[model samples]
Target: MTDSQDHFDVLIVGAGMSGIDAAYHLSRTLPDMRFAMLDSKDSFGGTWHTHRFPGIRSDSDLYTFGFEWKPWTGVPIATADEILRYLDEALDENDLRRHIRFGQTVRAARWNSGTNLWTVTVERGVETVTLTCRFLWMCSGYYRHTQGYQPDWPGMGDFTGQIVHPQHWPQDLDHTGKRVVVIGSGATAATLIPAMAETAAHVTMLQRSPTYYYPRPKRDELATTLQALDIPQDWVHEIMRRKFLQDGKTMVRRSREEPQAVAAELIGAAQAYLGPDYDVATHFTPSYRPWRQRVAMVPDGDLFVAIRSGQASVVTDTIKRITATGIELDSGQVLEADIIVTATGLTLSALGDVAFQVDGAPVDLTQSWTHRGVMLTGLPNLAMVFGYLRTSWTMRADLVSDYVCRLLAHMQDRGAASVTPALRDTDRDMPVRPWIDPENFNAGYILRALDVMPRQGDRQPWLMTQDYFDDRITLPAANLEDGTLVYR
Candidate 1:
């Protein structure tokens, strides 16, 4: 434990997108800082590495999804392989590979106020190791990688066909010429249906309710045009990222300001893709307004194309039970299939479900309040790297990494050992709200984890929001001596 290998200036958990970005910023802004990036997987790319589902791709465009400092030269919506390659290059180009340890999973982190250090227990293969760090950066993603969420249906065990979850797709289970039924209507289902339809005999999307879908070409015209003109990748990345952000901002604003109009436009887009005679209302139109949960992307209108070709179809009905052969709907209709893929959703895991302690007491994040959505109240030298729910997650990750570096430098300037967020006496009466506003964005994973997440206050720095535009302004100009953050 006394060896230099056991100690670091900072320990960044999860060597995925955010972890690599944090390491890059630390190397550039805090060059002398000794840091390490750790991940449970055998390699980088958290979700991408774990999800081997066919035709797996990003829901958001890669322009903004890529690191702010790095440029993405691939299609707007990139595949899992493309993203993994990009992450690999980010590590190699920034010399961040040396700072990363693969197959190292953090088990628990205990904070010591006396020495202002955190002793972390890690599971590395067959060995248990202990490491100490002055600061802990949580870059691990929000969902559980080992298991995906699937509802227990009345007869799931009775189904004769192969039931599979997209999170753990089997390598040997080929869907070629198979009668496949994908349960769910989110991004994963949208992606799987189209890909499976290409080879499967026929694919049917069974959904309890419809989700809003936005259509866009696979390749971005502007990025392609600029690339064709021999423009530099960095400039293309900057311009495209800004362009996408502005357009997304306008759309988000319109959804809030003019919900009905936005909803109609979204529904109409589906009508245009599927033919005028097609019934968009029964299967494509959602009862809620646009962006209520998430408007999944239908890249190249593939989902509709599959529908048009009769290779795929949608069934809007509640499942009465999963019979031995297929699913029985509430309408007394049963769907028969050779394979059933459950693209239900993901399960949220706080701090990768790692146990934590502070000052010899078990740390319960549900009792803590988020300080600007990064640092938690009463947690010294620990900050999380959560991202935007509506926008590309990397957009917020970049901003947070910058702010963390700035805060670290500020603490160094004052010769302080630790900084923690604490509510002032005047803040005692502030009402607490859910971690995320359900009215704005209510993703199932976030809602399910509400009881386990930190509370938000009614005022500044305490009222954590998903508004990226407001955050872009306030996070950089955040006040250090605002009395909300206590330094020791």
Candidate 2:
């Protein structure tokens, strides 16, 4: 990559799904606008490209997870390789690869009101390059790609075998016929247990507490039925997307309104897979309500099948420490292992932890309020793609892409150089809250990063409502003439 300073109408940070969607929208909607996409990694597919654990797959169904514009003909649940292939195809079909500047990390962005441009400093290897853009799009995502979150347990150095975090998986790792102990109950752990059980001597999934596992078929019945009828791929995609969205909205609403009923259905499903003999209450039932944390999807009940086959087992107990041989349980049980896989959650950063300045003053993101969970209050000409937690992530990405394009077109028509979200007289006394409400959803990763993320105001435009059903209707219908978004 060259070190020369360049200017663009829009600068998109990150070449992942969000960035690619934004770029695609920009290309389609504003064909004459100059734009560039950057990713710290050498290639696209942010999480898909980076996470290389065994049987790494989408926790959410691909119909909702896949981009709305692109038709996904693959199974509902897809592997990382499959997703990468899909993403790669999207890039190639749209001629998007040429617009991406890989291996460049956005270091800092300074917004100057005088010039109405963002002077972005990016680094590639040892060379620092400067670029400016009229509008900055933060599609970098929230997850820290550099490392996964691994808790520091005592005697970790004493362990004789390889201890790997799923995020930074070793390419040459061979766990065949080896005793593996995976320390997690989330999606990664669920995916790995069955995958490793195929070759490993045995795999034990150790969790401090249980997470709800929702077993679903790999293929969507509707999609398969439509394909059998020889319906067009685009029509099938839209039909499935709408069906899933409506179903998901109803489920989420029910999860909120009838927590116990939703929880019972999930537990009953697990019991059906594990059989009546298995301790479903101890290992399958979550203490919290459904959707409090993302329910891990087990395609075809693979994990339960592995457990039922006696090739794999689940141990719900607190870890005391790591010994030379295996993990020591607080219950005085010692499980030996040849390999320990930390299927721990992600290390997140709000807006990729990049330094931002507004006309020279450093922006304090934690102090600012999120505007529709897409743009930030007091941040001019900037929007970050923070996707849905309960639903498939790509759904929110697609919506935000359309919203951004619409916003840009509105600004152009109004001859506006910059737009910022400012609190009006009506919003002066509005109460503030955390990025995510703990009562509604309290995942460990989100709780850990509360102080590092932006706050949310109590009202409509100021709140970062994670509801996709509401956002889909509200985002596009948002009035540009509204007093909240100040145009200059």
Candidate 3:
């Protein structure tokens, strides 16, 4: 038990946005505490670093996604590279780059309640390292390390041509002039189909089911002008952030209350881009309510333009099998293709599969109850910060970070050893949904987390308000007087 191990007051398991934010606050408030951040990859920015697929951009606007302390001066809808650069800048600005240990994957973390510390085991190449910390923060974003989900299709192995998954898009795999079929109707499919159409001989987007699509402008002119004019960056960020949040909230509300109207308007606009003959209902109409899952965002309607120009096409049908020469549909139709891109879907992993332990017992997250989609009931001295599917993720992440900081500060003031969400509620009749979407559809990892995540209060603190203004008050500003959170 007394093996040689580096000990820290706080140990962060990721160097991405959440980890960076935690480090920033800890450094400012608890500067005397030893802190170190470890990441599995060779760099910071977990998702931004892992996902290198073409045409990958932030679906959410930058305003709400921007950090509270750091104003995002870049364009509203930013590319993945741009976001990575921004994250790199944040690390440098806060002098957090040196404290990070790259290529160190955390295998497991065990909590010794008696010692009041966590023994973290990590793998770094050939060597295994163990570290100890008083507090552990998990920030390895979801989706299980960029591995794409590939369902076994009948006759898949029979096809001689190359099959590609979006999560592992091969850089050298040339598809020029090759008839390509992209499967799945999620965000990735919408993004890749349009971009791939430019060069592929012909592209077909095959969707197992339809999804609601909304076209968003690529650039916010007001945001760009303000940034250029040397205006207060936070001011611009705040205004634009509020506008976008309101826009998204309105869309969600309208989709729920006036599903037909909203659906018709969106379908009409999308169909106008395509021809009158294109089957919008078959390809675009989803079975769930609008905003039930995150509505796919299309900037500039590039997909629409691609379809309109006859460069790409959408096909909504059940995939029966992958024939050597083409794809067989459930309707008894076979479409020929030279190459197939299974933009199928991604496998959802729980907080990057971080192994959790309470009192030396392995924690099964599926059996745990989510508290505010950020913390877990009965999970002590820990919190997870993944965003929601319905609203901008950063909106909740920012709030959670502030709240966690405040909670830490509260623990310090009270001379408490640790804090946790206590499961002392007497209400046994409370409903419980799966920890995430159990069906494994591509509705997005964050959205599924919200469905099972706990609401703040029935009426008092207010439920998980996706709205930034309400969250700012309830999380960062509201009194942490709730009995559910205990300090000891």
Candidate 4:
């Protein structure tokens, strides 16, 4: 690979699903435009490559997670390795290998408004290099290479037991014969508890607040049975995909309309499955609406059964402080533990903490509102691609990539210098809150970029249209010169 510094019409940071999708689209649609994709790691799959926690699998099915052009061939909910392979194959098929600069971490990007270009600084190995580009599309997914969010508990320093964070799971850390207490009831915690129960002496999931958990069928037996009855694999996938969308959307809508009813019904189902002794209200009832935060999907209520069988337990209490022996609750109860897994939550950042500048002035992302959650407001010749949390993130990301292609073509045809979002009065335009886990700002990643991110409005696109069928018409085919977008 040539190490000589080069210039490109567009520069993309992070070669994750979003970056890869953007690069592929840019390469195909704007073949004449020079472009480069960078990754801090030496691999293409960003999160998939980095996150190797036990039983880690995508929350969404693959039909939505995969690219429109590239269909998913593996299991519906793919493993990390399978997802990585699919990403690699996508890059290979699209001939994007040469365009990606791996092991290069972007330090800062300054936009020169006068020159109408961005000067990007990247650290590769021991040397720092600079790249100039006409446009910068930040595809760096939320978290940077910084360590995961680990809270400074009161007695963390005194605890002699092995503490593990899902982010940096030590390969040598042994869980055998250990009584583990996994903190946080998010997806990671749900995944960890059952897996650890199989080997550990006991596993307890401690949560300050209750979470909504749904039992999702793992194999889609009906779809499989249909396939055996002579249904084509593609047909099976499409049927199952539609069914999932219908059911998911219905639950989300009903949950918002009648929170208490939905909560009660869910609790009833859980109690029926787990049998009475478990405190379903305290451990399963969330204070927020059903879809306020993402609901963890447990396959076949496996988590509930794990707790029912005495292999695992769920404790609903505020951690008053951390003790050397165990986590102390506000009620003064301390459950001893041999291991602690702080599956607490993650901290999210915009552009993966990569700096941005418009002309000479530094871009204060907080001052700007997101333009359909894809591009920053008032930024010209730039766009970002982030996936959805409710549905498959990749589905929205892939559509955004295609839209960027169409947008690039529109700009080229009209000889436009730049495109930016036209800010409107807050009263007229509704606010949008991103559909992410609502952990404390300091405790997780979402804190850094929350102010900058648009708040979800009560309306359609302004509110994250978690549905793909709606976004297809709105994003890919929608008029580019809509009043919200301005071309320079």
Candidate 5:
């Protein structure tokens, strides 16, 4: 049964980092435009709110992860608590809390071409609520929020230890003086080993394969120096942001041009941290090239230090099965442990898994093509934010927000209510590719769910470029009058 009907000029989904970024831009640019934000969770912080595992921190620097308008005066790689505090401050300072409706999960949205409106169906508790909006902005992140990816390993009826996934970590979980085994070699496992080693009797990082690990200082010396000079916060932010972005670009370029040199440098850094006798080549060297998957950040070489001090150790082998005591390896080795932490990767969920329809006909996102990495082909007045993989997610989020604002202004100027990206005759025959090329990024999570995502064309506007520098320059100067985007 329908409980209520509400209307707005724009409806923004998910109040996470991307959603917050969109709200900030929309409020600043289109103040008069009637807009409302929806978050499935009760609170504002999306990822920060959900991920409460031990040693949870940002992989990217705070200068870039933090909003462009809001300067983060904290460590480069901030903890979950610090990030949450920053988000809370942003929410209060901007007065955005008033516009957000908590516990409203959008189930489906239908586009009415004749009326130039989207009828959105949201599940609010037991009753269904309907809302109409002129435009839809999807800020929900691209991952399953309720669960993390956990593979079913061969096991007996029970293991003596507590098997836990970091996503759904128990608050009262006690690992003190207990032997802990953390599975997987991603960010979560890297973070867990060091922190758990502090209290645990011993921590073992068991990995099926190696991952690229880069150790960086928690604090930025240049940022501190600029602050010491009495420079404004915004100025310092801008300077640091640009420098980091440029440095990232250089690193990517170097990785592509001189893969061996880059790999060697990374291995050398890990060897230095773990000591010369450590097996850096076996444990730290990845089979794939650098940045193929995200390079895990080890702040202040904590993981290596933990390993060096004999608090933690790394094991490189495939798991055969889970025994009552611990996991048996393919090499006929058994790891005895009291606790097992499955730090497995995430499962991808695009656009909050909402179903779409166009005047009663089902709209399949997998069949559609992306436009400027934001809007989809044939989807009118809709924008979905998917950030860059190589750099800070907020960097791309800022650009997308600016572009959407420009688009809204353009529509208003033209007195247009419907603006859709239409496939022209020239683009009809263009080669369509997967959403993200496997060659570009072969991360297990992405590859596992690539078929469900929207496709990308080989040409401009339709092509999804992961390069932040390219997007920063191209998205701003993009002509609204381009024939590809039909404004009615």
Candidate 6:
């Protein structure tokens, strides 16, 4: 046990994209504030460092995905190595590495009202350590890192060939000259199929349902043109950022208002890449509106190229059982494969699965409401960064970081030791809804964890719009004295 007097002013969990962003904001906004960061992983680049699967890359454009303070000079779509390098550069340039303690997994955080601080317990290797902080910032991402979601098939153990999950890909596994079957049509599956097809004898993507996919250029022509004109890097970054934000807004609106037309355009693009006679509708046309699930980006149409070249194929059928050689489909067909890659989906873990208690009482996240999409209701001096689904995650992450810094500044000015978003009497009467509407953002992982996640009310800070443009103006500029936020 350590004395509470030695605690940091702020303690940040997870040294990945969100944590690094928070640290950058803190450094710029409050250089005098004492803060430290802890990450379960041994290094930075959270997801980028963890998943070393083939063809791993960003599903969103780098201009939007990259930090607002930094200019991304690479191509629009970046590979895992490129992203890891970028993160390394960011940490070095900002000197954030000095404040990070690696291999520290936070297990529980208990808030003490008497001391106005949070006591966090973390496990580092074989030792247990406890620390305290005035504020707790959770940057740990939404999904579980130890394992991805793998459904129980009738006979998964019957498979004789090697089976792998993208989350835990074997470094020495060989795919060359082998038949591979990838299960799922999400981002991971979409990325793996094309990358594996180049070396595998034949690759098949077996999905129960189709997913919306958009072909994005590997390079950005507008950015290239601007740079060719000798435009400043900062100016180009801003221009591209705004352009992508507006384009994302328009795309989401169009997807909702004119789903059929948007669906046709997406399918038509696939036809262009796969040849005029290819049956794109059977494998690419999603039943739901675009953006309901993330629209997987196929960089430079690589997946379609592989499919057109006869190296890869798509089978839309449910698996009835797993055989020794491959999977048996409900349609009375079996796809034989030498290797099986289950890219099913991710399992959402709220706040890194850290158990939270306030004043010795357990905090049920499901009953709490979200405040401005950053903090949970009734949680004092805490903020969690959960990014937008429609746009690049960093867009919201950067904004949330800026907002949290502003909040801390306000608290300091008021000499307040604690601040919590509490529901007002007026808000209590409002309808409580799921944090997000499943119909609007029905990604499988989100739907799976909806029951355990936080809720949202109908009005103001209690509701999360998931719109960057709307949040950009409201979150940073809103009055801190709003009735919902209680400062003490």
| TM-score versus the correct structure, for each prediction | 0.98, 0.98, 0.91, 0.89, 0.97, 0.98
The TM-score that candidate 1 achieves is: 0.98
Estimate the overall C-alpha local distance difference test score of candidate 3: 0.75
Better of 3 and 6 by TM-score: 6
lDDT of 6 by residue, 1-488 (tens): 65744489999998888999999999999999989989999998889988999999999888899999989888888999999899899999998989999999999999999999899999999999899999999999888999799998998899999989899999999999999999998888889989999899999999999988889788888988998999889899889988887888888999999988988898888889999888877898888888889998998889989999999999999999999999999999999999999998899998899999999999999989999888897689999989888899888899999999999999999999999999888888988799789977989889999998899887788888898888989997888998888988
Enumerate clash totals for all models, in the order shown: 0, 0, 0, 16, 0, 0
Per-model CA lDDT versus the true structure: 0.91, 0.92, 0.75, 0.76, 0.90, 0.91
What is model 3's C-alpha RMSD? 3.1
Give me the displacement of residue 11 in model 4, in angstroms.
1.9
Per-residue CA lDDT of candidate 1, range 1-488, in tens? 45798899999999988898899999999999999998999989998999999899999999989998888998999999999999989889999999989889899999999889999999999999999999999999888898899999999999888999999999999899999999999999999999999999999999999999999999888888999999888999999999999999999999989999999998998999899999898998788878778889989999999999999999999989999988999999999988999999999888788889989999888889899998999789887888988899999899999999999999999999999999999998989888898887887777888898888999988977888898999999999899999999
Candidate 2 lDDT over 235-307, as tens digits, reads 9989988888888888888998998999999999999998999999899888898999998899999999999
Q: By TM-score, how accurate is candidate 2? A: 0.98
> Residue 282 in candidate 5 has what lDDT?
86
TM-score pick, better of 1 and 3:
1
Q: Residue 125 lDDT in model 1?
A: 98
- Candidate 3 segments whose C-alpha is farther than 4 A from its true place: 1-5, 224-230, 425-429, 435-470, 477-481
What's the lDDT for residue 257 in model 6?
Answer: 95
Candidate scoring better on TM-score of 1 and 5: 1
lDDT of 6 at 161: 98
For model 6, give the 10-residue run with minimal summed lDDT. Answer: 1-10
